[model samples]
Target: MEEHEKDLEDVPDMNKKNSIIESGEAMDQLITIDGEERITSHNEFEPVPLTNNLNADELDPETTAKLRGDAIGDTLYSQSFVLKTLLKFADLNWNQQFEEDLCFLWDMTAEKSVCEYLWELSFPSVACGAVAKYTENRFIEIVIGTLANVLCVGCDKTMTKEEIGVIIQELDSDDHLVLIQVMRFISSVAFSSSETPFIDEEAMNRLCFVLNNSINTELLLKTLETTAKLTVDFKLDKNLVNSSLYNAVLTAYCTLLGSAYLELDTKDGILACRYMLENVTNICGYIDRFENATLKLDITENLDGFLQEAIKIIKYLSQEENLLPVTDDTIFFMSAFQYIFINLNVNYSPEIFIAISKILYIVSEIRNEVERLFESTLELECFLISRSTKQRIFKDLKLLSKHKRKTVLDVVLENGPKFHFAFDLKDLKDEVT
Candidate 1:
């Protein structure tokens, strides 16, 4: 009985030893295969494992794709994708969300690679499409505003002649909202660079069409403002004024001036007047440059026609009704006169000189603002004296007196050519006699 008890105890000891060996082997397998150490229930611990793999399903698709694309070092989000998404959202009238995403992508376009991608996708086409598709002003503004921001930041490499042509074609859309945005977009593009490829006669003609149609007061003014910017390029301006569109542009200006003068007391009317005057000043600057070019070519015929247009504009603006209520408070008209005086150098054309003199005479008679007119005239006389070296200003003064009963000539004769030295009143006295 004792021997049997000893065998049983020996059996328990052997079994315990085998169990411990198995447990150690299991722990070794865990460490070598799973890279995780196993812990014992008996107050023993093991080190935590390091992981090499992540469950990608935990991340969103965009993040996953971004990670994958970043691993490969290429852009994960494409301009086309962004543009398509925007187009889809715009079509659905999801404007707020569209703008949010659009601004994000627009910011991305600052990257050269992204800008190149946008060029590849033809961003202008997308912009025009958005403008044409969405009747919502804010949506159109977002799309166009994005484009303008891009251009303003010098992402003009995305600009192409084909894209510009597409924008120009959209200018005829009867939708004023679309038209206004298109003008704003074009203005932004043109102002982006002096070497912009978008300044063409067709573009100018389209702009003139907008001006002539009288789409809206704001639209007309905006179009006029863009036209003024475009005319800053002398070649473009000369081509524009000499094109078939010139008549349309001039008619629009005439209509604007007439309307402005008739509605002078109103705010819109005053803005319209100021815009037209600014446009005229731009045209005058173009004329000055054109004259310089023509002088080199020894040509003067086109200049005469341009001067006649200037006279017509000045005459309309200086009409008795337009100037009769001219008080110290007539800010826009005074500003218009100042702009014309600053921009229109009469030494370029005899007709312009005569027109300026006549306009000054009218202004002096109406407001008795002779001192202001005299200062302007003396400035012109000084420019003429320096350039022509002839005291012909007194002759102009005499002619101006003959046309108007009360003239600025009295003011000029009193000032006596402050900027000229060889001015003898004898010549003036002879011309008067």
Candidate 2:
């Protein structure tokens, strides 16, 4: 019995000693793993085991789409189970290898899906830092080519704004072709009408950074197109929007447009002007918001310059001969000019208002402007009723309605003869009347 009691006493001591030794080994292991000898207050606790926190289920659909899109061009004939499995678990550690593989496959196949997927992942933004570590220039080129094609609307119309937004978010993070792609896409979709992309400050900053740095003319024009679209699509605080970026895009676009001298059978200036107006329709509201210093200091300073630059571009274009590309461009420009002039007038910049009014007179006479800018003249008249700039239109209308001004009357009379050269205008008019 005494021997048994002695053994029990010894057992506890032995167990305690073993525990101490094991604990010491664990501490040593932690120190070695962390590659630090000094234990600091912040480093006292060990991290949760990676395996313990991993989810075993499939990734969310949005996440899966992002992964799949990014994985394109990686496989020649077979899908990678291991890659898919890692993504399924949301294992960020594997993203580097995955992006590398996707870029590789993108080069090998020239497959649209791969490029499309990469666009969706917007690899460089969210994954760019990691991607730069593993990727080379050649691979990035493949992705950029794919993005350029997609930006021009090459695929089936299945692509939606959400998918495009995912790609754009990534593009906004860098100042490369990805950034150009964002500009082109927004310009094409948003500037065509009042439609807007999924853009915000975060996205704009990324795009603006790219615009500020880019030298490519085509890409710069596309960026301008995007800025114009952004201005029109949303009711925004104009000053609050990235003023430097906006001005850069507009200046670049205007410079390129003049350099190209791309002729339009339609009144392209009016369209441009219209797009500009659409972008800044509610300057009063934007200015009112600037009453607060945080907004005014941050947002207003930029606008003063941008608005002046925009006025200069319009003034320059207004003086030049008109060329109409698409019909919308003309009508859009006319409306845009009206908005600019009014904004200037309301803000009491009479010189600018007078200069724009002179351009309106020129636009009314120019053959191209008449053809391109007149199609929706009636609609523009109606649009004026709803706008704060309605007071400015009375100047143009009074000339039209009263003096029988050749510039205005000719526009009203010449409308259908040239427009219906390819169609039966008389029959259509009779049907409408």
Q: Top model by TM-score, which number?
A: 1
Report model 2's TM-score to 2 decimal places: 0.41
Clashing pairs in 1: none
Predicted candidate 2, C-alpha RMSD: 23.5
- In model 1, which range of ten residues has the least summed lDDT? 1-10
- CA error at residue 195 for candidate 2, angstroms: 10
Q: Write the per-residue lDDT of candidate 2 for residues 1-433, one digit (tens) a residue.
A: 0000000000001111221001111112011213433211111222211121224255686765555554434322224532352243233343455555544333322234433454555432433333343333333333443333333323323345655565555453333434443454454444333444366667667556545555454344445445555664343334446445545555544543434432223234333333334434433234344443343344444556555655565455544454223244445555554443333332434344444434444555554646545434422322222232323433434433233333443443444243212233233233323
lDDT tens per residue, model 1, 1-433 = 0000000000001111221001111101111215433321111122222232455558798878766653311344454556566557445646455656665564444333554555556666777666655555445544664565345334436556766666666665665544655665666665544654566666666777666666345556567656655555543536555434444454555555454333545555554555555555555556566664533222233334444545554555455565555543233444444444544434444445555555556655543554554345445533444444335554554555564512444545555454454555445555554
**RMSD each, Å:** 28.5, 23.5
Model 2 ranges off by over 4 Å: 1-133, 147-175, 182-202, 227-232, 235-320, 323-328, 343-433
